[model samples]
Target: MKDAPLTPPLCSTDAVLATLPAGAGDLPGAMIVWEGALYIGTAPGAGEGGHARILRLPWPGGGAVEPVYEGPEGSAVTGFAALDGSSDAGPALYAALAAPGGGLILQAKAGAGAFAPVTEPGLGEAARRWIGPLALWGGRLVAAAGRAAPLVGAIGSAELLIEADDGSGTWAALSEPGFGDPGNVAISLLTVLDGTLLAGTVNPARGFQLWQAGEDGAWEQRIVDGAHRHVASPALTACAAGEGELLLGSGGAAPTAADLPADAQPPELLGLDPATGWELIAGEPRFTPEGFKVPAALEGPGFGWVKTARICAILRDGATITAVLAATPQSARPFGLPEPGAARIWRSEDAGETFVEAAALPHPLVAAAAFDEGLLLAGLAGGKVRLRVAT
Candidate 1:
């Protein structure tokens, strides 16, 4: 595909509207867009105890980001899901909290005072390391938990908990031995497509693979085999069924001493057909130049590579996807470091075919969500947040 000129005015960049009030020290964990508001969760920052809190930013911009729930100190929120209430249940938000002792999944209704913990029935005292990438599929809340056991080694596993309208749920393991080795991989992303739950993992031997769980609770896995023995991790998002594709961002495996002179391998973005157990449909060119270290979100026109200072976050608006590129420069060569880098917005409307420079941003963007009014809510490094609307 022919590359588009790095043009300007395809998008706009705005200033920081709200700086999340950092308690003594806090690290932003997860940010999501739901119900016309921006929800942010913070983990413990430097010198601060690990305390988890949920902050809500109302719509229409220019408002205070307040903490709705302040949990015990040292508790970290790793995942979040917005739940639409059923006949017996009311609208609520589901969150996964990772504490030092163990992890717990809690549900908080819209009007309810506080969140109530949902116990994982039949799950005994299993070790929980990280709780995240939560998904709500077919009346069940699914999440990945890294279990650390003395003899079993570290295993990345998934659990499906029955989410009843009455706030009662039951849990079952989705990663059992016979199917295949769960290995010691981390489940980075999870999504529900066409009544099936899809999970992306970074495993030891397989590099990256997409695992699917059907409505009947059966699981199947498909490895995204790349040319020249490459490692890939699947990142999934829900679009218009056929248009929705799985993104395999490159990372994890680094070149060894013997492979120094060799060129750094770029990551491949593979499109999957969800119904057929993640069948590889098409493979796009490795968007980010090789050896760039961490290649962040594939944003803008969705086609070509938008080399940024440091990729902070990626947001898609209509057919265009905007990449929040940070301005961090590196001294290392072979990584294709940006020259005179600064934070800016790069957009692509052709599905990774081409890209153009959009707008200049103040801080490094970490996360962004497209709002209904054509506005983009962006979370930046150092607890800064901004809103970028169409010019």
Candidate 2:
């Protein structure tokens, strides 16, 4: 039989946890639970453009929201990574910053201290303008350098891979796996799985390519060479119910000038096993996944199929894994969500092979993090937070 639906905890003076107040033009970006607190990154909203802020809030119960770091004006925190500090030290945190002239990488020691710019001085200039989110590989911090934001066109090129030495804070560019456009390739996704570092590039003109680093530190590249032009979500999660299986999520292409029907391109979830390679587990390129299929009863005016095309975030919950996804209109604004759109959660059993709609959330759920105690914290694009208890 179907079980009770998972819902967020009730918010009250005593039961409520800490909350961060987003200003008039502040959009929350990536969020992660680390070091006994909730860290959230905020991007400058429509009318407010400047340096972004990272706020830290004590977790589990209630506390004051404090600004851990305030970036320079005209910069935003693109992504964050938790460091595996040396045996003598506690874990640290790293933030990836996107600025007008170049990118910056900041590192903060444990205990929510001040963040310091760790990006090598000349490295950002050598790497074009912007840096994608940072990830860790074999104890090294990795970031992809790309061209600064384009006003009315697509970026033609980006740096392949750059690694920073955790001990010395020195940065060095690495040899490409020898794939994608030597000039125009930019990394669109970065994550780690079972100690292996996985990277995906943004090459809409030639299709998205996946790069993997093996134990020997060798890199291999594969092109998804399919109808989809990009891999919208690149995430890794493990299922604990049966023999552990690693699941990878990817799908959706940004609408290009050609004006393709994005609604028809749905995100796909794949499972990777060492014995085998990649196998499709959920979603089809041309059709919506069964669990997220929009019911006829909920259809309304301005309802577009954009949400199923992308998988936003994936988190583990008990015996199942939950994915929060959204669908919006094709004409929706790029930096923000449409007024009222569809953003919902889906639960998957059997390692993402199938899923069931768990709950529908406010539109444009941009970021999500799962706490240790079955609590889910999500950051919406409209400067709001959603909290839920995994059932």
Highest-scoring model, TM-score? 2
Q: Per-residue alpha-carbon lDDT of model 2 for 1-391, expressed as tens digits?
A: 2222334322111122533575524555656677777777766653466667887877655477788888767666667888765633458888877666567787788864778887753244733556656777767777766665321145524454556545655566654522445523456567777676666654444445566776665667533532132334321211221244455544444311111124424455555554544445553433322223322223211122344545555665445666555454334446643534344566655445445666655434444444455434343423454343333
lDDT of 1: 0.48
Quick one: how many clashes does candidate 2 have?
4
Instruction: Specify the poorest-scoring 10-residue window by lDDT in model 1.
Output: 253-262
lDDT winner: 2
- Report clashes for each candidate as comma-separated counts: 16, 4
lDDT of each: 0.48, 0.52
